[model samples]
Target: MRLSTRYLVPLIALFACSSPTTSTPAINSSAGPAGTSVSSPSSLPELAADPREPFLAKAVASLLSEDHLLQRKIDDQVSREAFPKYLEQLDGGKLFLLKEHVAALEADIDHLDDQIEAGDLVLARRGAALLAKRREVVAKVVADVLSKPFDFTKAETLETDAEKRTYAATEDELRDRWRAVLKLQVLERVEQLEELSDALAKKKPTDEDAPARPPEEIPPTFEGKEAKARKELAVRFETRFTRWKDMEPLEPAEMFLNAVASVYDPHTQYLAPAEKENFDIQISGTLEGIGAALGEEDHFIVVRELIPGGASWQQGKLEAGDLILAVAQQGEQPVDITDMPIDKVVKLIRGPKDTTVTLTVKKPDGRVETISIKRDVIKIEASYARGAVLNLGKGHEPMGYIYLPGFYGDTRGASKAPERNATDDVRKLLEVFQKRKLNGVIIDLRGNGGGLLGHARDITGLFIETGPVVQAHAADKKVEVLEDTDPGVAYNGQVVVMVDRFSASASEILAGALQDYQRAIIVGTGPTHGKGTVQALVDLDKLRANPQAASAADSLGVLKLTIQQYFRVDGESTQWRGVVPDVVLPDPASYVDSGERSLFHSIPWSSIAPQPYKVSKHSWTAAQLAEASKKRIDSQPVFKKVEAFSKALKARRDDTVVDLKRDDWVAERKRNKAELDTLDPKLSETKPRVEVTPLEESAAEKTAPKTAGDKNVKKRIDKWREELGRDPWVEESLLVLEDMKKLK
Candidate 1:
């Protein structure tokens, strides 16, 4: 998780900045009007306290009430085949609550039915009153949570007594303890609520008039004015919340945590129980699916990343930013799952292997297209691999470039084959560098999301003989220094490491280790992903089966416990402090609102003990790198044009207009296209053509701008033209290599 110390300065400065002038006038004139209902912020309801008790309590109650009304309907429409393999991960506590809560509501439902049948108006009214009261309790709990936002930094000071004690423990144990707390107390509760809802839905009533119809029947379709229309449409649908609907409310921040927690460790997961079964099945390596990593970007269910060689990627039909408007199973009605949780949407898309799922996609160019894909298992062979060339420069000099996608392995069944380990691959790659008498090597770790820790250390050992690589610090304050035991430099030639934001964890470690030794010149974006902690997952199935033997809170499925946080040789924690590049380069992501710091509830930056060691300074200093970059950029045409385009792009994104009209939208799209087209003749000429129409053309048109900003488009086209001229960063890096050749 990304962490930052930038916020810490604000707290310290708050007192310094406080003054009579800084204090704004109160809403009330001279102690406010007598009986104003404006309560102080302190009087707000306590949402964090016992959230599990109330949150789950409401979910349990809702599922129970809905189940009685819709059980029969579900049993009829959805077959047993749709039922998940829930046996493996059910928590006894959660299951018990589900059973008791549903049964209690069912009893009430029966009494209501009888009263309605007998025309007992008084009794029926009384029963309705009771149900309403129960619902009020649920609503109040949710309202309390929604009233105030959560801040992760604020939570750091709110750790319980138990956490303090655990934090004082040994490194290995401390990391595990912190992870367990997050999994059990934070994630487990959310999962249980989702599972409970699905389980209780096994029984649904078929009577349409009894519960009234859901708003989805006349789905929220905004055909005008982007902002106003969405607001109005949302309000209209929300008004029908009183009635039973096959819908669940998902908090973005909470769900983001669940998705990211798993990333800390391969095995640890925090899936809402609805997705538990699907996640498990996928992990086993045999699942039918549109192999795509889906996520919500500004309320749209967007395709974040495509699994290489998957149906979508191979077809070249599905683009990374395309928004899925609708999903239609072969014989069923289309489901508009827009604004739905990612996991729930996955359920509708995935099925038995080879099943055809139709996707209605909205492309960035405002074109919509329908594509059918048969789900299949994504092969391991598809992930990037290792190989190398002996000759780097046929005429100028002998150098090599090695691309390392990531330090990956089949963790479920780690391949012992030497080819699977990145270290092994790199080792062989170095052999080529040596054999070819190369002058330098570029280790490309651009999009590598780190894998095994052992590989990180082993890879570092290949560069330097024997010294500390990275240090580990536990919450308990224990420090462990990791050293390169292999006292041999496999390839000691001038080295350059290339990275970007996607390069994280093990990638950071390798880069940091090399930088510490002054062994390589790190080149790329400002910083790598600031994920430095290691996590271990505790399988919930095993925990629940033997509750007595397991830890007190072990039944919350797999807990990806953060076991240790990494530190550089100089003692700087990489948690929030990523590996800063020696030479910063132009990155489009920086111009856009994207990066580790943009995420919610990221951890805070912290530090620990530094390893005692020093390395001889390389010939290039920070100032020299800057001077070279400036000179190279001045001479390069491509970088200058890109810089200009990036500025305009940033301005447009920052000042986005929410219009409502097809004509305006068309105009805006054309305007943007025109600007991008003018950047460079070659660049504009390279633009791809649109073959499909947008899914919601009318809706998009409503949100389009009335006046086309053709000037902006023209500028953009010119910028692209300039980009064809040259690339300064690449040129500067090449120059750096050339300089290093002189040093050797």
Candidate 2:
């Protein structure tokens, strides 16, 4: 469960100069126009309200009713369903609000539909007020609990899973709950400090100049470590509370509207202005910003990774794991962002090209420095398709390996011809593979969350000699079979497509089509992410009744409306049940309950009439390969350990009640770490089974650097090749390809 404010943002000005009109049909509502008068609930507490929210809500409701895949009405039933969803977005962990507060909110649950229909945000306003009150109370409770030392010897347990617990019956119960939660936080921090201390103590000096750590430098006592943890946790909570208090009314309103949208399906959503812009950047694989991927950790905006050849990477000052403390324009005072929302922080940092933005960041080692970076157009090279050549040491042929992070396309460019896209990139790689005459190819789609549907179709065509790729079933009961009419295959070699639970949407389309046509063997831990539904970005600005009120409508945001459900060429819909792979691998991800099936209000699986298609001549029987793979897996020590690790993970996930006692917690952490170590041995410790190398042309490009950006590009490619060489999955794919060669 994610908070509503998480989606609210003005991240970048990349596409701010242009507002591309969506193809989604505009909705005309009978509920008057923008700024129409609606009766407000006098009983509800007064809170700042955005004038554009009512119009946005009205437009969203109209669009969903008219164009949603399910064509479900926004009635009393939807209202009842939305109420709990709204609550979940507000207080997902069941931490802030008490049982009495939930009971009070539930009073207007049945009439929520009426409120939305009337363009009145009575429920959202009331809920926001209640949440604000609870947040202040919770903050105080957290501070009070962390002030005193906890009894580490007491054999107490804490129910960590939010779903398994209910709202606290009373304020006293809530206080006790916070006590346990804070103790767990402090205990985990203490364990981390102890581990660091131990690692430092055991370190060996490499040279005479290398200074050894003094005995006095290490914190010897557990009590001191506990005190440090508590102090840090107090600051973390203080920052969190400050951020929550600063949240705008639009954020809650967006959450409330999304609850209404989600009643139809999980994919159907309302994208706030900033969120829509972010979505565009993701699909296009480009952004004009600082070029650093930021993530919120303990309410602090931390730089996760720097895009190669990006502004931040070129600056050479910002590093991954650096916590941004403040933002300042050129010659401006630094604005403190201690607990600011990540989106808001991004808004301050992202600007026009050649603009200088100063960021005050705290390094991992606690060094604080202010660095200025000139914002530029950042092309996310990692998001595009890239390939490498893989070989098994002796008496084995080299196979082509391509990893596509997403089915990306330049959406911001003219529709007639995009500057760069996934299909073109993959096609170029295939051409190189064809030139080399590689016996087989492995397309790794693991952890790919999908992108453009058209790109998925085009890429699938690159592998096969043209066929029906997927079927789209619309709200009007129309079945449209999307086919790849292209006449020739790019590289018709023995193909192996790797997937995991995270591979979804466009990823599912390609994998499922290849599997259905018998063009490739799908190998994964389990079924792919079953997000079969298609969503269209409906610009709410275009749905306004009065076109002259352009200024008012511009800020209305966008609705990501679910319009259709896609199915495999074999007629089976990858909705609740995703595409199951031919070969199952022992992976910890398989044990986790996730994907479309785990999502609330997810559409049920359905099938249509199978499309006409011819099976590939190069097809190998999956059963035979499965049998061979199973035999190898059963004998392999690594796979055996993987199986044990998966089971242990499943057991841990099932049992959320954890021991809060410091000693017990430490023991459990050690056991978990030991399991992880066995599953993921150090890269240096493990011998590489498969050797990965760049293609001849790619190697030449790496040596001939025309600019500093080219050097960074080479570094990225080299890093990719090294990581691929160490991958167990890639090794397995190599062996599988070898088996295919023999079978052929």
Candidate 3:
């Protein structure tokens, strides 16, 4: 798996002010026992070593000190902050060592800023040596614990949130902690095996008149299944332990530097050379794989987001929060991926197009299922600004729909012939609707995470006459106003913008501008994701001439820095508090804490004088639309079921501790599955099993030689059309459009 760089995504307008600005305190204490453990600095992680250590250090210092838009000062306060952050970066769980080890490392906490300023990392290196030693101690403990298994009924609990707990006070306490951890793992797998055994005992729904019979090769007893599960779980943990033993200095150095960058913003991060290349592949968006975004949480690779036109979404089997347990090729033995990093999981899932990959995943409800997906070129079809007609019955008015997954454009390409972009694609769709005499249009930007700023402005221009859409400002007070200069409004009879908490950056920009002018009725789950900042990728290799440094075994990586802030035309910066919609809908994401406010060191939200823009042709108060939608939701059965599921999902998310008791745990999962089943009926209707032909294209237009990619895209179009009738959110948005139509 290739490592990817983290970018600061400000989702809220947060102001940071704390920790006193001061010089380092005078200390008479010399190097402590922590520093003495490593006689020489050569013993540090191998990858952490850089022949141009001084040069790299100075280069980073110069950027943070002078070039960064934030221009954060690295004083004694910053040193104090970096101390604990770097410690967490090394060992957040406190599983490796006792309290004394942490105390020893704390002795040099006051000098980290000074060390960085001086272009020396001796203090960081000393801390790294202690961490390496602690890891070795724990590795041996894990090996011994996994050698044998027992005591499933020990009635012990393991606190999974390591950051919230204190360090082990003694070696005995640390060993006990490790034991509890292993017990929990064994209990989880035992529960899974029990479920599997029960599943095997039943006849599949498709088995026509077949008798309920277990497979001849498999074990039927509970104890036998438990033994198999335990052995495999232990082996997986052992493999992870081996990887820990292979850690190098480079890993620690990267972690430490990334921690420093995080102090400014969680998004600002250091990327290794290999990781930088991976980042480029990700930006390209055309990858041969199952089409899913993988992220690590609590050391488990979880499904983050399914690419709209990818195999995962098309399969409609996997969901966000599903824990990927193992990966297998066509006929190979399944390889457990528990505790493996996300990059490795990606490499395992990706393969040549048309190849088959099977993923064993544990659902959020604790139900384990194996998803078999054929790998293909996963492209962002929704990101292409696609159009479809939402059916509203035989006699009802035809409502047009467009799902803009992102404000995408050829930012890196020369805007040459056949330049495909979000704005252009959308304009073409609007023109198509104009010819169709559509009653209304719904622009869906539910999961749009934003893209090019230029496209956002042009997209917004398509709705309104001439007006300012967004404003960009630098720290030096340089301000630029981006506006829609054209007065030609495209198909402005009625407009509705569909958005969600995932809509961010340029998505927020376009949504905010249209809502401000009352040009469109905004209908969504809630406020947009408050990511109102811009990032510019800066290459460390290009920062200076001949930056030939002995930086580990790879070339220097790139830095994605937050360089500018974006504000809506209404004078409000969409930094922290994103754009609020006219008609709000119930969403599971709203139950969770998110947006810019959830982040640390986020830029504060402020307001400037509002820019002048033409009033919307259709004048209607939001209360009218929201009130109409509310009335509709009060009696909506699908919405009622959706609300119940949202409550259940929230409860499950907040309560991280799983019931260790097998019977109770299985019962709990059953209840969750029962609750999910009610929504499944509606969900399955939208995401059908079979492929669908587009309703808009002419017979001749639809006859193009369809590739696998084309079919994948058609699924998205078909599913959206299906959802136009089943999805309460879309139904409600269509209702909102009707209310706007009446008011106008």
lDDT of every predicted structure (CA atoms) = 0.48, 0.74, 0.68
Model 1, range 327-374, lDDT digits (tens) per residue?
A: 778645446665565556778888766677777687554445566777
Best by TM-score: 3
Write candidate 3's Cα lDDT for 288-366 as tens digits: 5887767655557777667777877777788766889888787665688865655567788889988888888976644
Residues 1-744, candidate 2, lDDT per residue (tens digit)? 111222223223323633323222122223223222223333334345567767877777777787788888799999998888888877878887777667767878898788787788777766776566677778888998998889999999999778788988878888899899889868866765666576656665553212233445446798888887787678777877876765543666777898888788887877666455555544443335888777654436777556655788667789766888777776564566765755567779889988888887865533355677888766566456778889988888899998887776776656565446788888888878888999899999987778889999998999888789999988888999889999878997889999988788899999999999888889888898899997766656656666347552256667777778998988999887898999888774556566899888999999988999998886468988888988887887777766776676666667778899878977886787676666653543567787888763553223232543444566666766766787777788778888888888
Ten residues in sequence with the least summed lDDT for candidate 1: 83-92
The reply for model 3, stretches above 4 Å from the true place, is: 1-49, 198-218, 285-287, 296-298, 321-323, 338-341, 362-369, 379-383, 411-419, 547-554, 671-682, 685-695, 698-716
Best by lDDT: 2
Q: Model 3 scores what on Cα lDDT? A: 0.68
Q: What's the count of clashing pairs in each model shown?
A: 42, 0, 19
Clashes of 1: 42
Structural similarity to truth (TM-score) of each candidate: 0.56, 0.79, 0.86
Ranking by TM-score: 3, 2, 1
